[model samples]
Target chain A: MAKFKKSALKENDGISAPETTSIAAISKIKEKRRQKKSTSDLVKAILNGNITALSQAITLVESKNSEHLEQANAIIKACLPHANKSVRIGITGVPGVGKSTFIESFGSYLTNIGKKVAVLAVDPSSSITKGSILGDKTRMEDLVKDKNAFIRPSPSGTSLGGVARKTRESIILCEAAGFDTIIIETVGVGQSETAVHSMVDFFLLLKLAGAGDELQGIKRGIIEMADAIAINKADGKNLKQAKLAKVEFNRALHLYPVKTSNWQPKVMTCSAIENEGIEAIYSMILEYKKLTIDNNYFYSKRNQQNKFWLIQTIEEQLKNDFFTNSKIKIELEQQLELIENNKTTPFVAAEYLLGLKT
Target chain B: MAKFKKSALKENDGISAPETTSIAAISKIKEKRRQKKSTSDLVKAILNGNITALSQAITLVESKNSEHLEQANAIIKACLPHANKSVRIGITGVPGVGKSTFIESFGSYLTNIGKKVAVLAVDPSSSITKGSILGDKTRMEDLVKDKNAFIRPSPSGTSLGGVARKTRESIILCEAAGFDTIIIETVGVGQSETAVHSMVDFFLLLKLAGAGDELQGIKRGIIEMADAIAINKADGKNLKQAKLAKVEFNRALHLYPVKTSNWQPKVMTCSAIENEGIEAIYSMILEYKKLTIDNNYFYSKRNQQNKFWLIQTIEEQLKNDFFTNSKIKIELEQQLELIENNKTTPFVAAEYLLGLKT
Candidate 1:
């Protein structure tokens, strides 16, 4: 309804290249192009410390498409030589335990100390809950903005095995991209902790003081797997309870047999929110690393972990091949019914099924 | 020698058909015949509560000959309908924890109460140690001599899986032979406890009093799986220590999350040597059985166990076939070396090997 400029009406304004639209959409397209790079190119870029290339390579590794499998393998194979140089630490705690905040604070501290930190998660429940943990970058606001840190959500998959495999491969890529410190986070609710434990050099469990029934909610065998336990929220009125909890945990941990590493598991108090006691935790880790390296347990443990993954992957695939067979699937249900009716023993049923496979 | 009776060596004294020599060897041959019965005949004999046939069937189950596989399967299938009628109890303890004595006392108690008892063992180490456990039935002398009790030594196998399978099948034969109570014993040192736990209706851990560290010698997760812990050697001066251990263990047990069985695990003190507290243990088992049955956990747990075994057998065979493959064995070593040198990720290596298999 207002006055129009006469020059605009003249139509001589030669279609000024459709005003560069949606920067976010363009960047996403760019990302896709980056991820579609040749396997060798991606590996070369990753080895040169290119974060975008590292992320792209991880996407390829996590891809369910059959076509991506070979490329992903090639990238991992090429990147393998540059990997194994990082200090891989696994962090685990139950849901309301402020895992994101802990990782953010801990990760920032590592970066401040001139370390390149890469954070990844293994949440088996993510597939069902559509990534309930680490899915939102907002949860780690400062770390997300930190140029020296890389944050990634849990990979979505139908099974924990699939997700764990992807995360492990991504660790290699991150390490190749010059990530000196890798933090793997997992919810301490299921078998995901075991997978994470097998992949990390050290495991840290976070706990809150005065949760009532200190050990009641802990999963079985978790304490045995931890290299250290940090009683978080050790500030304000909670400080005394946290210190007491630390002593109790220390006592309980000693009840376990001495670890083969000859390093005793330790317990300490920390405030991930207030960022208190963070340096001490890192110092403790450095001490542990020094001791383990001196004792040769560090290298030996990595070798053992690699061997475990090799066997685990083979077994998982073997199971997938067998259980997914159409005929076997149909026959399995029938055998289960037979088991229910007590018409067949499980061993006999298994033998029959195995014969059917052949 | 000159004083021997003339009838002993007379060739034609009374035209005696060569006096039968070596009565022991002749009886052994008769025992062999009893073991080699046809599948249907063995099933019928087992169903008719014939202990000899039950033992023979168990031997067939334990045999390594491929020819016996089909026969064993048939016997198990025939026995299936009559199985699952007994209360299967698993007992485990360290070597010096009086496992045999406890079984002798408790098993005798069951038989004396008009309950037919069958004792079997799963000691994977037995194959290597020539069965340090149960191999010598002389350990359970009184129970062995009881007509109502049948004691079978641990079946020896190179793998725990194989030994566990044999013991599981033997349970079927024993149940079909009218054994209303089955007692499975295992050395508490290895994975045998887990194997035993999967198959039993109740798991009882035997522990000595005042072992200095009440929980130190326990393998990880063993206490979590126990339905009850009996602090043995509670007689004499050890009584006070055993009571203290009971209190300590009870406190530790409460720290664990309630079991899915909805029944809290119990800790008690007993003296196997003095034949004290044996009745209390039996009462505890009875109480557990009643609760589980009333809540329907007993039936559900059995079903889950059957399914577990079925899958376990299939997976074990799958691994066996893969590892034993000539090509895979050669490639596996190469891949392992590649892993050592960090030339390939385990996932990538596993994929290449799996591809080669096809």
Candidate 2:
């Protein structure tokens, strides 16, 4: 019964030890200094590539306080000139596809090749799950510790639109901090992929070799949006299937019309954990960059994205205002019931509701 | 050239014969009576299967006159209980894919099987080309004369949304007129296909076997929407290629996840000009109807589509109202210019514009 003995009680780290009492005073002074910093001082620090300033600016951007929002908008406007210099890449895959591993290996490779990398996420479900995807730093332990890399979990928000807006602004902050490459990671499940695709220059879909067809479980319209597909975990017993998947995907990709960028989307096999094939993927992206830039699509696409976002924001706000109106919400339910009973058509009901809003 | 000389001394139909002058008096009286008839009477006549009344009601729906729209809404509300009884099938194909011939053959089959067919179109380009798709009665000469069939060209509207609304309203008129099969046809280019897809129970894509791969010229996102793909012009030398295309398309269709309808989309070869394979297509639709009905998806899907239309109309109207505001328009341009100069972000610009509107 006594095969194991009880270990000695350890000091609780949750409670501050007596010797660390002086640290509290330093924290209060630091907080006071942060409060005293002006908007211009924050902007200058961010432009000077100060990581702490960048993090603080992003926090302001993600804040709910109207005062913070005003400051954040001012900071972003100041940083706008320095943005759009980075190659923003969006990477997405299902839960078990090793997205963090891929990013760790690929991002580390970028830093090694003398590129500054920033990783952000746009998980719409982060609010409910409380940032499940990248909340744990141990998932990408090495990349998190790398000096040239900045990793931020998805910002929690009440809606995908809010979260996407935060991540997009964070991208500007990251870019102004002298990062040349930005990676936005979204889970393969929701509307987040489309939001990510709109903001990024190149979209890479991460996949795993299934037991059967390689294209079995792809979300609709995703292959069309992807600039490349990387089959992660192509190591040990999975290598052969991954190669076959690459060939299959290549054939499938050819069936699509030539992209507007005139750069054919590429498919490759990579072992993120084993650190295999990451460099080839990077070269492929660079090649795509060269082609799209030469063809004048890079700048034009970014301009289109800007216009799209402007219209998208306005339309979303318009819809929110209408649907959230006290009278419209109640009358909308009645119209739907009328629609259910076939007493009114959707068009007629919509007209009635619009009149109510006015 | 002499043989082709103008036919000698034919009485001019445009000027009318002297004896027909009496008929003009009767036309005036009939016009007066039509004007005097109330919306309820028009609704009653449509429910009684009066083709003239149905056509007049649809014209009102397509009219831009405010008074006509009011009357149209009244008639539609009265007819709403009689609508939603027919099966709506959407047919789309690129120009020169023989869309008219396919509809002629397929629609005639439905009529022969004792079904009343109403053929409508949603050509967004109709405004520019003056209703190019079905404006010519000769395109479906036989069907145009069939008492069991009602055909309407795409309504000419400045916006696709307006045209789509007219067609949708006309569908109600046709259904109330006792048409059991509603066929909505759209050209394969632009946004018309999506509009048509949202309104129909079954979406059929018409394709021609290309010189190379059969999938070479398909517009993006179309194959995923298709419930069936019929390869036309398969009577001549194209037959062999059409069969090969069927096999290729079958494989491609399998790659898509199962539809919410739980019906596997089919690929078939049909010679519309030769009138072959028409009945088989009908049988396939009946089978799909049976499966969906058994699974309770048929009613659920219709309900979902109704809710979708209601929300869609509200959103479109909201955007229209916002963008059409004169003050917002000028400010929007200014904000865009600022965005181009990197002085403002899309989010901030949108906020400023929205604030100005309020």
Candidate 3:
């Protein structure tokens, strides 16, 4: 370790002939080494299914500090080769649809069946200035206590894009730690569902029984994105209504154009509290996985998602940098004012604001 | 005209003196004067509702010649003050859903009510190397012959964005030429429907009656964008099924979340050849217009759309510029290969390709 450190420092000295042996610089190098060694240890531990290391690595990934982000990147780089072995599933539901309870039930069932399950969340709305639905952390008590079940709450206070980036990287860490089934839970109301859907192999939406489907949050775009719908809380008095909803949801799904995946989205009923039909939903996911794998869509879809995220991240960061430029911000505001007053068409205004000739 | 031309050319003399009266320069000035006089005359004639001038201006807007583009820009700038007076409606349907025939029937109804109508096509599919669906021209025979109606076919062989830009500018020209009602038609299968939806005050979709509603072309996103649906070909034995389809559609729409406009989209059945329900559909548009305008949503929605298009146009162009760059293309392909091989995560790969130390 000392020899390697000396060689690395000497290479830096070769670039800049400053202070390879100075006390101040030496202390800084020692501090960096301490942080780096911990990150390396974390990766090693995580690969051995050490849950504590997994949690610490995730905390680093979710940290807003620059130093933590660098170390998190290093840990993620080491974990990448060990990831992508899990079947990722995204689950979403409205606030009252019992997503947490369902996940707890579902997670416990998977663990009982000898599957190591990791449950993560992408909830940007927790950052909303209004009251956030504090549902994930407190609702999954059983899963939190299970040795084979891991539950992580959504990272608080960030944009959906930021939260998505963190949770997605954390997925790699979880997978590297040997979790075979990964579930990404999101609230159906926000743009987070789209982000979750992009990273998951199967997307499931949970809905309540009855005409409550008319709730103002479940948009057609979300419904169309679902690979399956589980009508939750379908025990006892609500059983008939839940069955009816399943039929209606099936018909509604049929009205949609055929999905590109060629997999017809199924609707099922499950009472997470009663532990009814939870096994059926898992079976459905396995069926979808088997079907997609047979057709090579599993690998192809992952490849497409990787490319999608690559371009999306690049474009989004580029846009952020451009928009945050002080000059661009002032000019953009002026152009928007011009458009509002009808001085120019939006396209012409954009061209002008972008420094192109009129 | 001669006096203005001489003075305009002489402004160059105010800056430089050498070529003020040279024969070659004088002849070129005269040639420019001839073109400028005709463009000004074309604008004058269009403002007087001359169909021939209207046709010529649209041709210029659709042209690829650099000189024609400059003139088109000048014409569009001049026409802007006289535009934005029309209620622009976007109509979309599958190729066989009888969009042109419905427009023909609807246009004739409007013309009979003393409203001048202009129908414009946005068909990017013609650019496909496969045989184009040339249905617009021949399907609207009656409207083509009507004095108060102007039917312009799609600008052939361009992208959806290019075609949208052309059709949007053409609507301005048509509005300036006294067309109080403009119908922008798009085939629903492609991304053109979104483009059409962006520019129009109201969006109408035409659907056929049958199980073919599950056809892969009609994406749910497009359906969600519709402000109204007219089930066409309700004249024959399809009438009963069409009525049933309307009820089903209304119910299906209810299952989706409410739109921000706060105006519930309406569905109605219509028969183009029989002219059944044509006027009722028009009445629905007026009612929607009244409600939205009363609730102040119409203005707000239009503003939102303008802002959306401005940002969308800029981002898409920026992406095109970046992806088309020689350096970025090669680097992007390499990063994609790395991602496909699981050597690096997409976000990290993107960062490296973008020149960041990941």
TM-score of each: 0.89, 0.88, 0.84
Residue pairs with clashing backbones, model 1: none
Docking class of 3: acceptable
Across residues A1-358, which tens digit of lDDT does each residue of candidate 3 receive?
6657755445444455566589888889988877555777899999999999999899888888998988999999899999999999999887788888898899999999999999988888765354334343577788888999888877775578788888899899999999999999887546888899999999999999866553345665787889999999999999999998888788778766767677899999999999999999999999999999998899899898888899899898767766777887888888888767766677777677667421
Stretches off by above 4 angstroms in model 2 are A1-36, A128-130, A209-211, A235-240, B1-36, B128-130, B209-212, B234-240
Q: What CAPRI-style quality would you assign to candidate 2?
A: medium
Poorest lDDT segment (10 consecutive residues) of candidate 2 chain A: A1-10
Flag regions of model 3 displaced more than 4 Å.
A1-37, A128-136, A211-217, A254-262, A356-358, B1-38, B127-136, B211-218, B253-262, B356-358
Every candidate's lDDT:
0.89, 0.90, 0.83
Model 2, global lDDT:
0.90
What tens digits encode model 3's per-residue C-alpha lDDT throughout B1-358?
Answer: 5657755445443555556577888889888867654678889989999999999999998899988877877787788789888788999887788877788889999999999999887788765354333343677778889999998877875578878778878998999999999998877646888888988989998988886453334565776888988899987789888988888788777766778878799889999989999999999999988988899988777778778878887787767766778888888888899888878888888788777322
Return the lDDT, model 1, position B62. Answer: 87
| Winning model by DockQ | 1
Give per-residue lDDT, candidate 2, residue A331. 92
Instruction: Return whichever of 1 and 3 wins on lDDT.
Output: 1
Interface DockQ of candidate 3? 0.36
- Measured against the native two-chain assembly using Cα atoms, what DockQ does each of the candidate structures obtain, in the order listed? 0.62, 0.56, 0.36
